[model samples]
Target: MKNKLLKITTNLWFDTQAEEAARFYTSIFENSKIGRTTYYGKAGREIHGMSEETVMTIEFELEGQTFVALNGGPHFKFTEAISFIIHCESQEDVDYYWEKLSQGGDEKAQACGWLKDQFGVSWQIIPENITDMINDTDPDRSARVMTALYQMKKIDINTLKLAYNE
Candidate 1:
C-alpha cells in the first residue's frame, strides 16, 4: 500500500522558537524527526522585520503526525482554548509524558491532567481509556472517576481504576 499524505497538519506559531520547540518535541516522542527548515530572506522584509537567513519555519513529525513550527513573531500567544492530548496506555506512559512535557512549564496551569508547557502550549496527558471511564453507563462510577481525575494534576491510572471499581 502507498503511504498517504496527511490532509490536515498542525501549525505552531512561535516567537523565534520554531526550531527550538520542534527539536524539543521531536526528542520526547518516539519515531519523530526534524524535516525541512525554511529561512527568511529579503522577501517580505518590510512587514516581517526579521533578519535575513533567520529561521522561518521548521517541519517535524511526531508519532506519524506532521507539524510545522513557524517563527511568526510575537503577534499571538498560546492559550488553553486549543490544546493537544496525549493518550497513554499505561501509568508509566502517563508519568513519562507528564514529566517530560511539564518540565519548566507553568505550575498554575496544571490540573486534571492538563499542563502548559514552557513553550506556552497546552497539553493534556490522559489515559487512553479515559473516555471509556468517564462515559461509563453507570453514572455513579463515572462520577467517582471524574472526582478522582479532578483531584489530580498528572493522571493516576490506579486512582482512576479504584474510583471506577468503587
Candidate 2:
C-alpha cells in the first residue's frame, strides 16, 4: 500500500513542557514518535522572551497524525472548546486511552468521554459505535444514548449499546 501525503498538522501550545507532553503522548499511543527537537535561539529570545537554548518545539506524530508541540510560554492555555477525538475500536481501547490520557490531569473535567490531560489539553476518547448509535434513525433511541453518555465520565461501549437498544 502506498503512504498518503499528510496535508494538515495540529499544533499544540505549552508553557514549558512541550517535550514532556510529546513524550507522554507518544508513550500512550501506538504508531507515535517524538520527532525533531529544536531550541530557541537569540532571535527567538527577542521575539518570545524565551531564553536561548530552551526547547522551542517538538515535532511529533501520534497514531499517524502529525503535530507540533510548542514551548511558547504561559500566555496561552488549552480550553474545552477544542479537543482531540480518539476513535476507539472497542471498549478496551477506550478504557486504555482514557486511563492513560487522564492521569495527572484534572479528574473533575472528565465527562462525556472528554478529559483534560496534565498539560490542560482536552481529549475525547470515543468508542466507534457511539457515533453510529447516537445517530440512529430512531430519535428516541439516539436521545437515550446521549442521556446515558452525559451521565458518565468514561464512556462505556456496552452501556451505550444497552441504551441504544432501550
Candidate 3:
C-alpha cells in the first residue's frame, strides 16, 4: 500500500434506497451527476448473502464533492451534527435551495442563521457580509445580530444588519 490518497470521499449509508437518493440529489444540483451503480451478482450474493443484481453502491457528485451512497441497510441515520451549509449571496439563492431541500423533511430554525432541511440536513443559508458582521469588533452589534438570527427560520441579512445598528 502506498502512503498516498487521491481524493477525499464521503460514504452515505442508505436503507436500500441509495440509487433513488442518488438520482434525487443529482437532479437538485446543477453540476451533479450519477457516476455508476454497481450491482452484486450471484458470486457477490454468495459472498455477501444477498440477491443478485441488487444495488451494492452508487457514486455521485454534487457541487464538485464526490460521495458514495451505499445501500448497506439502515444501520444509522443522519443527524444535524454533520451538515452541508450553502452560502448565498442573494435572497433568490436562499429561496431556491430552501424550497428544494426542505421537501419531504422537517424544518427547524437554528441559532446564528441556520435551518435544518427535511432530510435532517442542517443548512446555513448565510449572506456574504455575515462573516464580516459576526467578526466585527463591536460586541453589542454582534449580540444584536445573534439575537435577530434566533427570531427567524430563514436568515434575512438585511434584518440582521438592522438589529446590529440598534
lDDT of 3 by residue, 10-105 (tens): 888776788887887788889899998888777756556656788989999999999998877666877777777777788778777767776776
Q: In lDDT terms, how accurate is model 1?
A: 0.96
Candidate 2 Cα outliers beyond 4 Å, as residue runs: 1-6
Report the lDDT tens digits of candidate 2 across residue range 28-92: 98899889999998884667999889999999999889999999999999999999999999989
TM-score of 2: 0.93
For 44-63, candidate 1 gives per-residue lDDT tens digits of 99999899999999999999
How far residue 153's Cα lies from its native spot in candidate 1, in Å, is 0.5
Off by over 4 Å in 1: 1-6
Which is the better candidate, 1 or 3, if ranked by TM-score?
Answer: 1
Query: Which residue pairs clash in candidate 2?
Result: none
- 2 or 3, greater by TM-score: 2
- How much lDDT does each candidate structure score? 0.96, 0.93, 0.76
Candidate rank order under TM-score: 1, 2, 3
**How many angstroms is residue 133 displaced in model 2 relative to the true structure, after the best TM-score fit?**
0.9
**Residue 120 of model 1, lDDT score:** 100
- The TM-scores, one per candidate, come to 0.96, 0.93, 0.83
Range of the 10 consecutive residues with the lowest summed lDDT in candidate 3: 107-116
**40: Cα error in model 2, Å:** 0.7
